[model samples]
Target chain A: MNNRMILAAVAAALVAAAAPAAQAKDWTHVKVGIEGAFPPWNALDPQGNLTGLDVDLIKDLCTRAKVECDLQAGEWSAMIPSLNAGKFDLIMTLGINEKRKQVVDFTVPYASGVASFIVEKDGPLAKMPMTGEKLDLNDKEKADPVMKSIGEMLSGKAVGVVQSTSHEQLITAYFGKDVTLRTYKNSGERDLDLKAGRIDAGFDSGVYGATLPSKPGNEDLTIVGPQLKGAMLATEVAIGMRKGETELKEKLDAAIKSAAADGVIKTLSVKWSKLDLTPTF
Target chain B: MDFPFLYETFLTLIAALPLTLQLAATAIAFGAILALGLALCRISGILPLDWFARLYIFIFRGSPLLVQIFLIYYGLGQFREVRHSMFWFILRDPYWCAVIALMLNTAAYAAEIIRGGLLSVPHGQVEAARSCGMSPFMVFRRITLPLAVRQALPAYSNEMISMVKATSLASIITIMEVTGVAAKLISETFRAIEVFVVAGFIYLAINFVLTRLVAFVEYRLSPHMRQPAPLSAATVAGEIR
Candidate 1:
């Protein structure tokens, strides 16, 4: 009897010690939201599956952090609100900007890109000087001349841009009353309008603009204006979380930092965007 | 309460009101004519005409307005034949595409309303008119048309107000109306609630004025139903004495 009691106490102690270890190995499943509409960063493939640089990077980051991730696609306008409402744990491919930072916490940037204009190959504005120049919109002196020339060239012409993007802001602020600004909900619609000759020009990311001319049936389209960066057009794109989610934000930041250092982001960027968009930091 | 910001946003949104009103006005005007024609076809007693009218109404009424707008704007543009055709000129512009979609959608609902009105015209009245030696055209002009229009006015007014609100969907296809400008403002300020509030008030004001105008027209058209003015207190007292 005495021997049996001693054995039973030892077994209970062993079981208690192993229970916590089992719990520690349990994975934390995170629900991630992504706008699978923007190409090269995030977009739906021909099979209706999410495939892009952001998708690849997020999967890698989640794997490295050992967190089980459930990725879902959402509309761009509803992303931040849904994140705040606890619909998702994090939003991938969010462009870091001052206005957005006021509402959500951001991880370290994973990629950066510039914005530009796409126009018909033989369009009126296509002949404008500064076809491939990189203009820093933050510099008024340098940006003003480009703005003046673009304004004169595009006056009374209809320009299409995605709504709620820096592209719309840039056109509205610079062109003002000189041009008719049409705002679309997504890039695909704007691209359609551009191809159909409904709009004289369309504004989008330089990476996307560069890819358009090469697309089958898009031979008439070409990047016509300067590659715009800085100012309202944010350079860095990162994952966004609801404010006060320090633990998740920290984990995401670390994962992104490691991914950048290990060249994972660079590999994905080159594969998707045909350029290295790995942020320096 | 951020009155200044609201005022500023209101001013910005107001600038786009003309586009909204223009879309609504154009769609409503064209839709009314199409509705009348469809209603006539439905009542014409011809099998093919009635079937065509039924199919047109079913397709437009069954689908969502947004889908209709997208199909006309984006989906139609996808076909090479559409792009190369003469209709491309009209289909190419987002504004016209939106108007065409809205007009078609509204016409479907309006045709049903007008059809109900036409049916509601008393058969006895038509028989009486025919017995009195009135010609078919004369009877239709003097009796059927007037009574049908009056019967349809109340429902038609509701459709008109809805058409005004539907104009906001045009923004999805890149037409900058009041809602489009509000969306742009929200994007810039990141104050979605405030910008939308101002936009709501602008729409309310427009609809309020429109409602009153519709009510006045309804009152004017139904003069035979108006009641005599009530007696004043002095007149009542004098009558009692």
Candidate 2:
């Protein structure tokens, strides 16, 4: 406790100390941060090098933007705080949402994907109604009945969610009263519990929906429930930066647009996640 | 400094304080019994018991508490039989899992403290008690235990304070203790600084009371350590100094 307190205090001090150093930027060198754990987005390889869709996408974006970028891997929790504290200039594979926009700015979304639940292949929720279907949460006329049925299916059952993700918020808002929530620090931990039957199902990215079931140890898992987007569930992925960095935001936004126009995002998304996540926007 | 938000955060955190205190109290209480058992085992002179206690201490003490927590919570679930066992009811709840982890971790550290206190019992004191026709158990009960506690009080106080702080780690397991609530608040609001400040203050306040309570206990145990009562200017009779 003492150590963390002192470190937070020291970080605040460093932010203050580095304030003057932020006078003006030439935009030649940019420091980018990634979790390096979220597979298909950004992750470390066996050789301890960063690789994944976000890694590849960032490289192309930086090249088009004509900025030299340095990539660093860190814990997910530290990404935003470190960015706000000036430790990193940009964070990759960030999901854009209103709650997050209050604290940081985001470039135009470069990729998009739906979120859904994963259950044991033989579990009661394995073939829930609306499975293999997609629903826009904003389209309440079509979504309401499906969501109500899904909620009924989840009632009294514990569902696992990764902490701080939009999925956590969505589940809480939609089924907070009916379902028991078990928040995890990461999807992998949540998966372990789900496989163990400690949780009835797990809510996560479509990448997990697409990739996790085929992974070695997760063979029994199957994606269930409707693919959900819009509203609290942020499907659009963007590069997060400290709020008010207009110059950097403009440069990155333009780069992201260029990359999307070139099919780079769609190509890399397939290479990493095998899902074409290029956003229509 | 958003005073209103800080105050609101305080209310939210304070509401969760009982859980934080409950975890600490439960851990400290049960851990004390476990610690006493291990300490006895360590000093009981039976080789197997001593080695068993030593091994228990070595493992729990050596590994990080977070790993132990994950092991007990997530690791144990990996075994199908354990999940199906009758004890699964107890092991299934995250609350109990956290309690079990906290209790075991504290016991390891407290065991050493208890052992040190027990070993600090002077040979002459035990010898005197034996010469006074007291049975070994009586000697330990009336003399050795009391003196050991007094000797161990200062160091033991530090352990108790740390155990209070250690309860914060239970947040990771989703216990919604003070730290847990603060974390969720930060994640939702993205206001890390205010939430952390509030949470830290909650912990600080708890430990402050804990230290004062421990100090009071120490004072009561050490009547001899107090300064002699000041001489009264108003004398009674002739026997006054």
Candidate 3:
């Protein structure tokens, strides 16, 4: 037992003593990352504080779950990577989509809005065929022809969508080069640019587009295109957790179900979305 | 090492070359004029002009270009009055807004460079010109401006290169330059490394050509420095001159 050997033993003892405490430490303080640019999901208010439906919903969920939640701002493109890198514990602005599920696990849906698109009310694409219809994207046999015609009509026209979003994939997969795709980093920019006439069309959630024109001065834009749903789009929106996060996912799923059963989700959806977006489940 | 794919990516990036060139050329050309005005104001002996120039330079140079781009494109864009005002036409296009931001940013730095060049022109030479009956404007035009331009070329050329790289930030505001195209490609393909590799090579090539252009200008302008090495009779004879 020379001096170096004694120091090594002391370090080993310290680690051995600290292991239990480390295991016992509660991860009650949860960090939720939301995109401040995405409205009706999360957005920055004039005071530079995060607000919107997701912001409100996350706070409510955290209160019920008894977790100390610290909501943080993040950009959409960087959200998942930041979660994977441990910058935040969960991503909340995300709607549950299969492509995302391939990389991350999502809790049972908390709230859901239909997959929707918007065009200028009086624009050439205003008379797009799927008006007042919700096409099931899973049925390609029915969807293909309609999507093709729509794509052809929108030929040489620009569609603005968020990067890494299902809307981007949907427009690109169906239209390919027939339509010029502009992928924004988030919904606010896409909406702003669409209103500015930089883009001919924009796509996201029905609820988000519903909220855009109500912003202080953006009164001219209207959500006038097809309201799309299913397969290519997720049927519901859910909280995104890291893959293999079974314990966290299970806890969240249970919380979501309880929130739904108690009608907490419905009330919040109607309050924020201005329509009933409650999951049937 | 996928030659076909790499070749395709190269073609796609080259397709964006016109926009990249347009941004850099437009910004630098306008930036030079603005830089001249700013440099003159800093030396104009007017207290307010000098202070305003100092403040403008301090703020633009002190902040990151990305932050400034966002402040102009997104931050000020948040205001309803800004959206409705006459300035909206200029601020409406992301391309023009990007050019304005890049030009203003470059001018701030270039102004300082030009000011240094002007200050370095020998005072005795200007005094001698004045004593020889040259007007103040003539003294500046004959002795000051040319010398300052020659002195400023090296730093000014560096600023030009900086503007070329700075144009990449325009992608954030949705102007589809090389990086924006690369981002869209990667999002669709999910091949970040492959797309960025091709994009990086395009940037490298652009910078390389720009470096050559600057070197050519430097060589041509400093003709006295490039004159055939004293034209020794032995060397001339060897060369059959």
Candidate 4:
């Protein structure tokens, strides 16, 4: 009986030791999925590897969260499915939209930005938006008139937007029949088409538009039209986690809150996006 | 299927048809020429020529076409010299890059098919041609090439349908082909499975038409051979042991 007790104690101790080790490793083994082509957010450099703002942001967030992360570059359209399939634990650089809320959970908004139209600075449709202020799509009064003015300018014009994005939805929702909205699989290709004069304007995030001038032949392009934000733009960009990842979400949310409180977010936002994307709420 | 949306999807995919057709036609046309050259080199009796053809075929046939497309589009785009060189203008566009990858891949497979066709030309036929005072070129042009192509037609048609399916991958590089448009439609609606199914059906219809066309061509070319009629149950049973 005494020997049996001792054996039971030993087994219990061994189980306790192994349990903590696995838990500790679980926090360390983070697989981060990113859409590598979404530029300034995440993009591939000359080495044909992933890079950019989200790349930097993910490293910073993981370091702050005290986790070792493996960044996996995935095609944008398949990112969500890949994440759900357990190919990765987190999706780093996607906007927190209501539609996505049905599928996945998100951390607190790490960054907030607007979507805008990009057109040639000297092109015929350049000066038409005429509004200098960003438009909040949440308000119908403002959204209706603003969309009308934007539509008039966009009439008979080719607008390029990335597939499976709020920008594409916005273009289709507001100006479906009025304008020719061309969707691209990635922003890189749309940017190329814009530079090649195949597209009159491309609608993408303002953050991405800001980096367009840095591309080889896009020096002539400029952000035009009203910057669409708020409801139509989705909630904000956050670290997306699969639904049911409650603990992980809490951990990320806390880390994000701590980062924001420490001004790390503001610093990084200005450093990467060249603008203060620090969330107000 | 939502009738309106289905109709819209068809119209949208159809609008993108020109680009898809252009990609397939251009790739197959160029690939056929390259295949012929590679096939000849493969069987040319010269060791260097055979080795060169083998390596070319192996490299292209071994790797996934997606990797090949990416290497051509983004990989080659990485080099400063490639960007500034005369070929940069062509390489800069995703359309041409996709075409180049497709052509190269098809050429590798097509070469083997053509080579098989060439080998299928019986020794008796060549011997008979030579016995009739036919020169080598005449024998090859009339007997070998024709016989080889006939033998290769079935396999080549499979390749042709595969090429059509392969054009779907071009969407990754951002060409607004049928698959690209379908992806966009799904993104807006979030009905991925539906849109993809519709897109797949379009490809199926295209392949179905192509299969019939190839069958027609096969029948026209092989006039000397008699095709067996559709087998009745009795006929099938009679052939069984």
Q: Which number leads on TM-score?
A: 2
Interface RMSD of 3: 9.2
lDDT of candidate 2 over B6-124, digit per residue (tens): 99999988999999899889988999999999999999999999999999999999999999999999899889899899989888888788889989999999899989999999999
Best-to-worst ranking by TM-score: 2, 1, 3, 4
Worst 10 residues of 4 chain B by lDDT: B185-194
What are the TM-scores, per candidate, against the unseen true structure? Answer: 0.84, 0.90, 0.77, 0.69
Model 4 clash pairs are none
Cα lDDT of model 4 by residue, A183-232, tens digit: 67788778766765657889889888887887776788888877778775
Q: Which docking class does model 2 fall in?
A: acceptable
Individual DockQ of the candidates?
0.30, 0.32, 0.20, 0.17
- Candidate 1 C-alpha lDDT tens digits along B96-155: 999999999999999999999999999999999999999999999888989999999999
- Chain A TM per prediction: 0.85, 0.90, 0.86, 0.87
Give candidate 3's error at residue A219 in angstroms.
Answer: 1.8
lDDT of 3 at B199: 90
Clashes of each: 0, 0, 0, 0
The prediction achieving the highest DockQ against the true structure is 2
- Decide which is better by DockQ, 2 or 3: 2
In DockQ, how does model 1 score against the reference complex? 0.30
lDDT of 2 by residue, A87-141 (tens): 8999987889888898888999999989989999998898688887889999999
> lDDT score, residue A81, model 3?
65
In order, the Cα lDDT scores of the candidates are 0.85, 0.87, 0.80, 0.82
